[model samples]
Target: MEKIFTLAELVEEYGTEVQKESFENNGNLNRRSFDSIIKRVEQDWESVKEEGRGSKRKIKCSGKLEDKAMKKDGRVRSGRQQVEHRIPMDVIVATHLEYDMTQQASMSLGKWAVEFGLITELEYDLLRSRHSSKLRQKHIDKAIQSGTLEEDQTKLLDEFTQHCLEIYGQLVKTLEHMEKCGIILFYENWMAYGKDGKVSINPEIMKKILKARRELMKKHEVVEFNLTAHRNAKKVKNFNREWKETLAEVKDENGNKLGIKYYWKEYAVILKASSKAVQRYLETYCVDSLEVYVNDKDLFINENVADYELKRKVNIMKKAEKRHKQKLQEYKEQKISFATAEDEEWIRFFYTQQELEDIVAGYDLGVKRLHLQNLYMERMGQLFELYNIKGYNNKKHLEGVS
Candidate 1:
């Protein structure tokens, strides 16, 4: 069985070297010394324990094991009790003293260096405030002024700023994309808890509230329609004149003319119509308008702007031949060059030279069949026959093979 040393036992066995060093070196135990002692204890725990006891067995162990050992002893013996960490007050004081000494050394070094012209006052200040929030900015400024910080550190700081800018740009782009995608980003907080100590607007409660609102609107519309129909029940001889001359006309239960004020109901209908018209207009035009704006601003570019731009260029090329009759030959040449450049750029960024050459060759082979709708099918047939391959097929049949 593997022996398991408790934290206390490990500390006691390893800590002696650190304790002796602390006393000799003005009472200080550093992280490095502590780590070294811990490593040595892990390597030879039993040896350290024997050294601590002057080669005598200090740890008492129970002789009784399981059934056989207990039968032999005729009585049960308890297992060995583990040691506990019991630090003397002197050790704590020594630790504090060491910390204070180090702090004093750092302060003295910083002050002396600044005063003696070894380092600038600003550089000294920055070193003093190395653990502060303004550390990076102060370090960057000092590095820029003195040109003393390492190249990697300067590059890292510059990269950090670039990363922040990229993040901000992405956020703006994502928001614009969401708008174009018909997603309304609402920011609202409702009464979460009521004075009655009841949970008010939880997610479920909000869902119910929305349901109620829709139900209420539906009922309200039906009631308003009934009222309007009842009010318009009586016909006037001169309809336009009667409507223009009407003052306070009374309304029945369904708001029919019992001859006194139906204007309130008429006003309600006008308001409802206006509201519906606005909603309808937004539903029809808002999403497209937002998408156009997003595209115009190149907002989507932050996420896949390069890909989108490449696609856009390809689309322009496809339309060019039809749109530019007078410059047909020029458009064709431009399209071919654009395609070649795009392929080269993509290959350079993503592939090895040999792979790029293979891809370019494949594209060249496919170019002959470009005008065909099933161009891949035609090219694959030719490629397969040229290589004398079998069992493989063209695009349409390859779908089933996969």
Candidate 2:
């Protein structure tokens, strides 16, 4: 069995000078702040010991303890096992925010921490700003050290350019065809508005057109990709000024202009739909009939298929909304922690079926709280699709009857 140190012993051994300064007033080494940290560290240690060194559970320690352990064998020891030391905290203070930032998928742990009342908004903002700057500096140092700073920048620019090109190709054709047919495009889900005897492009294309248009408008605003601006050229005004203007002055060995600057205007002109008619046409299409194609087969040509898909989405949305509202009420009652609908959507987007199943199956080693089951069940509900709820109900009834 591993030894667990008491709060007093831990404060005596590992509390930083600043923490010790508060000792005279608080008497328990600022126990309010450190309590969660102590629990987190103990949880991590227990997880590592039970799961072994190969576990993804990060083993954290106080910097002073880690330094002492490193001196012994150039590695940190957790009880009888050697574990990798990632972040070092001095009595699990605000420094632990860095670990959360690293572990969080979206790097927005600070916001969530504040939302959960683990930290005050002021503390969250300050810590986020401070850590973000450190992360930026660290990125710069690593990029410079790898000698791939320029290469990475150019690659990113190229990828952005390609994305713009793809967007232009798709949107220009779809919008033009819609205009020719006098069809109006709506930004909302097609089934919501278009199912009532309306003709327009599907919701997917509508999203692409909107996103592509935004990217086109933002082309010049992208500072790093503005080659002329980087060179401090005199004709910066001409750069991304119009559809006719070239993007950059760079030329290849053959004197052919190079980079996104060369074809920037052309891409923008075609993609941006700058003409008032096209812009309005993008916002509103007036066509009464439309056909959707998938793999050269008309999808909506078979009304059954379109109906099936629409019905599927409607069922999904109904179930998701019901479950989400229930979870929200549960959260209000303090029976469970709840994620917002947007967060649940992200969970649906990012988590695979197997991953979600693993989480729901009590196999999520990292999160063992009682409310976690309730939370993940909500996520599973979000991902569930019931195209035939009536059929399912009948089957369930038969099974229950048996």
Candidate 3:
């Protein structure tokens, strides 16, 4: 099939020649003349191509240009880094606060040494004896100075400390940003248990807090969208329940079952969807909205029928998305470990998903221990949706279901 070049490409190739000719023949560039030109290209595609398909066509813009937004604020948002540290929670909250860090109890050296493999178990015991309880970063430094830890290990400790400082800085900046908005820490209830366990405030208190916050949320418009809009209907599979074999009704050889999937007659509508419907429906209108006039000899799918440049960009993005999903799947199945290449982008992406999923799942389990470690953070969970709606999330005026 011959390529139908866009107006921009033709203008670029023939320069003023095509534009002048098109202008003269069409009488000052009316829609009728432009349409005739496009129609002519459609009609004589083979003839034009057969004469000089020799030269490769470099496509140019086919439509209006877009403006890019740039931030005037000095705040720089860095890409996520693959570093974490065991900064004392108090120091993290109080770095800008006046304090002699040396006076504070250092983190346990035995734990740090064991986690980082900086020293042997016997070496850790010796160091712990010398420094007393709660081994600190200084203790690790002393160990390295005294020939207990290798020089490379000393470098690792320094990196850990630096990473901690960087994280603390980012945290402070984020808090500042939040404070600029209406969010604030107020009347926090905190408690703690053994390591690694986290839970919300007691259910009784949480119920009251959530009720109050939800009432506040009602003061604004509750933007809505099809939450499952991202799900591709074609790709959805039937749910496979383990108990189906036992509980499902018996089927005959013809595959007829005693039971079928059920649907309710009255579907409760949640959307303020009329405007959104128009916006989304417009996408599919031009696609197969009208029949193509073509000979029986040649027919093909027009899946990538947009502007050539746009089609190319879409293809590039699809390839990138495929690679990202492959990496994520590999990470999920334990094929890709983030330990060695923590800063690598795919590693950070995988770890972020893993960490967030873990935090969510962990929050779902056990009782509400009411262990609110960070005062500023406690009420943030309640404000999650509010942030997204109030433009703090940086996505505003969405046509896609909010």
Best by TM-score: 2
Model 1 Cα lDDT, one tens digit per residue, 208-296: 54455345445444332222222233332233234333322322235443332211100000011222222222223232333432344
Best of the candidates, lDDT: 2
TM-score-wise, the better of 1 and 3 is 3
Each prediction's Cα lDDT score?
0.31, 0.32, 0.30
TM-score of each: 0.14, 0.19, 0.15
Off by over 4 Å in 1: 1-136, 149-153, 157-402
* C-alpha lDDT (0 to 100) for residue 276 of candidate 3: 24
Better of 1 and 2 by lDDT: 2
- Tens-digit per-residue lDDT, 346-389, candidate 2: 78787765466545543223222212444433322322221112
Candidate 3 residue-wise lDDT, 146-244, digit = tens: 443443333223222222223224444433432232122212232222122332234453354345434433433121111111112222111112112
**Displacement of the residue 182 alpha carbon in candidate 2, Å:** 53
lDDT: worst 10-residue window of model 2: 82-91
lDDT minimum window of 10 residues, candidate 3: 262-271
Off by over 4 Å in 3: 1-134, 137-152, 185-402
Count of clashes in candidate 1:
8
- Order of candidates by lDDT, top first? 2, 1, 3
For residue 333, give model 2's deviation from the true position in Å.
Answer: 39
For residue 132, what is the lDDT in candidate 2?
38
